[model samples]
Target: MTAEFWNGTMAAAAAAKQARVQVNAAYPITPQTHTVEYLSRFVNDGELDARLCKVESEHSALSACAGAAAVGARAFTASCSQGLALMSEVMYFTSGMRFPVVMAVANRTLSVPVNIWADHQDTLVNRDAGWIQIYTQTVQEIYDLILLAFRIAEHEDVCLPALVAYDGFILSHASEPVHPLDQAAVDAFLPPPGSADRPLLDPARPLQFGEVLFPDWYPDFELKKHRALADSLGTIRKAFEEFEAASGRRYAPVDAFATDGAEMVIVGLGSMMKTARHTAEKLREDGVRVGTAALRVFRPFPAEDLLEAVGGCRTVLVLDRDIGYGTGGMVYPDVTRILYHEDHRPDVLNFIVGTGGKDITPATIERCVELARGGYRGRVEFWPDARGAEEGVPYTEEPAAP
Candidate 1:
């Protein structure tokens, strides 16, 4: 393994090269364009012998990847926000067809307000599209997960596409220390392209794919997809274990911090969790029993691990970078669904913060803790709320005077 400083985009490209990706089909999109660009450079330099296919649109980018994977080749792509929105149609088909194509999603906010910065709105909007979604908190995790995503997606028990999403601009541009495994170790870990275990699109096999199914059989296919995702949880754990054995760093479905005997807990996803962890530690020093839990894997839902992380707390503050409008924050509803079913559920509250790349300071987390302690549980609370209309300048990540 080699350790060096790498930005999230560079790390992803490095990981893809190490995985020996046979093809990379991608379109240029903000925050994600550099990943494929780096891969293209690698291919051109003869450092990595991969076919870099440049497509016109994000949809075609993923479609080309799906086509490559169907032909039993390892493929990758990268996009964010509008790019992902455009690719939504193919995203479902990619998973439904059981292609093991992996994509790096530098998550950004959606439109209507016309934003182009970091947020979970992009990925969460397509949460049910059937891809294995793993959110990363750092450049190292992003690199490591990209390597591991291939193994998870291509596993016989899974055979599903996976997405490694990180906050756009934040992790994407930020450089950090990363330990990347050598190609020798990676080759031993992953099977070569067009391996017999993967489905082939060769004329010799003459197999059909995505044939029109009648209504009677459509639901069965959907159910099988669900079952395959559920069953893949076991495979996910096995892959994490193997990765941990090879690398000294350990990973879990939920990354928990100082939860033991805590009175309250904060739950979130992606880059904000690093800030949350610091907030939790500061709160601990202030004699507040607070802990933080960041969800790593979103597709399988990691229900059991999440429950264990926040079950004992008096209140659980769920933070989200995006709101689901009338319903509230996305993670809040799901967390409540599981918590409400338990015999004794903690008071789980949802608060939306750091949307469109706003800095989620320690003070903001402190405010959340205070509100949770004060029994404030009603609607989705917006952070950095200033005197203004909903469609005003303050809503953006513009600096506001204290």
Candidate 2:
């Protein structure tokens, strides 16, 4: 197939169309609006034979999808940031019901003062919502992972919801060359609609869904869901291998670059890792043994794969785009916890960067490397120093020196 120019939204919409999604329910939200808009066009033009539910709110949109999935439909939806937060209540409901609903999250910062840009805060905050979270670095990955999310989510052993997230404007609005799979190829890769054998809320079968579970059964069911997510790691790996066999592209939970004999390795998730990898390569050229490892699968945590990637390095600099308020970087603690019990653990430093649309340039990553090399004492530090301003000055303005 020939490569076509597409932004992240188009790629995601194309993948959902190719997957033969039977139902798409979404309320328009920035960064995410373009994807649903494209899907709406596909449905209106008869290019895709799917029900387009224009819901009243993001919560209603996911509820519509969950209802569709409950009846054994191949359902999909897209939302990010505040929209995703609105969908939070239903997110747990959908996952608890074991619906194979797939959602595309255009990673955005949650608003307090209302800002729209790229960050992992929105999705990372929902990491424990029982949905398989997959982060992407490129438009092609957004396309591939959305397709794979359906396959993985619908798998009988992994009948849980999945989220494929990519940077909001960084990839969502930016165009890139993408070789999209044909419908035939996708149909071959993904099971035909209604092929998955699972308990569905059917009039004929009369299965109950979302029933109020008392405390006695609630904990057990929750345990089952937890085990299912943990066990789905193997199923996800199998799906990745199968997808690679079908398409010439390969994917893994953790993607490592130039880490063979590196002393310092940068670790991160989403689109910023592209910059981190480039920075690592440049540093290597300048006689600095730096490498990068990106976590593609965030929910399952991919601890072993990540351990293998950065285990040999002397220092692991974690570049997190989201802050955990009182705690620290969202991903930093996970990396530290994973390496804490290791026999030869690397020194891990967390640097929060690119919040609320701040650009994560190569220089930003270089600065992180410089700090890590200098044996910085702080466990967590914000790039560009959040406290750079004098007490009386606004953060946006330059501080007057004493």
Q: Which candidate ranks first by lDDT, i.e. highest?
A: 2
lDDT of 2 by residue, 67-180 (tens): 898788999999999999999989999888899999999999998969889888999988999999999999999999999999999999999999999999999999999998
Q: What do the candidate models score in CA lDDT, each in turn?
A: 0.87, 0.89
The 10-residue segment of model 1 with minimum total lDDT is 393-402
User: How much is 84 displaced in model 1, in angstroms?
Assistant: 0.2
Candidate 2 structure, TM-score to reference: 0.95
Error of 2 at 7 (Å): 0.5
Q: What would the TM-scores of all predictions be?
A: 0.94, 0.95
RMSD of each: 3.7, 3.2
Over 4 Å off, model 2: 385-387, 390-402
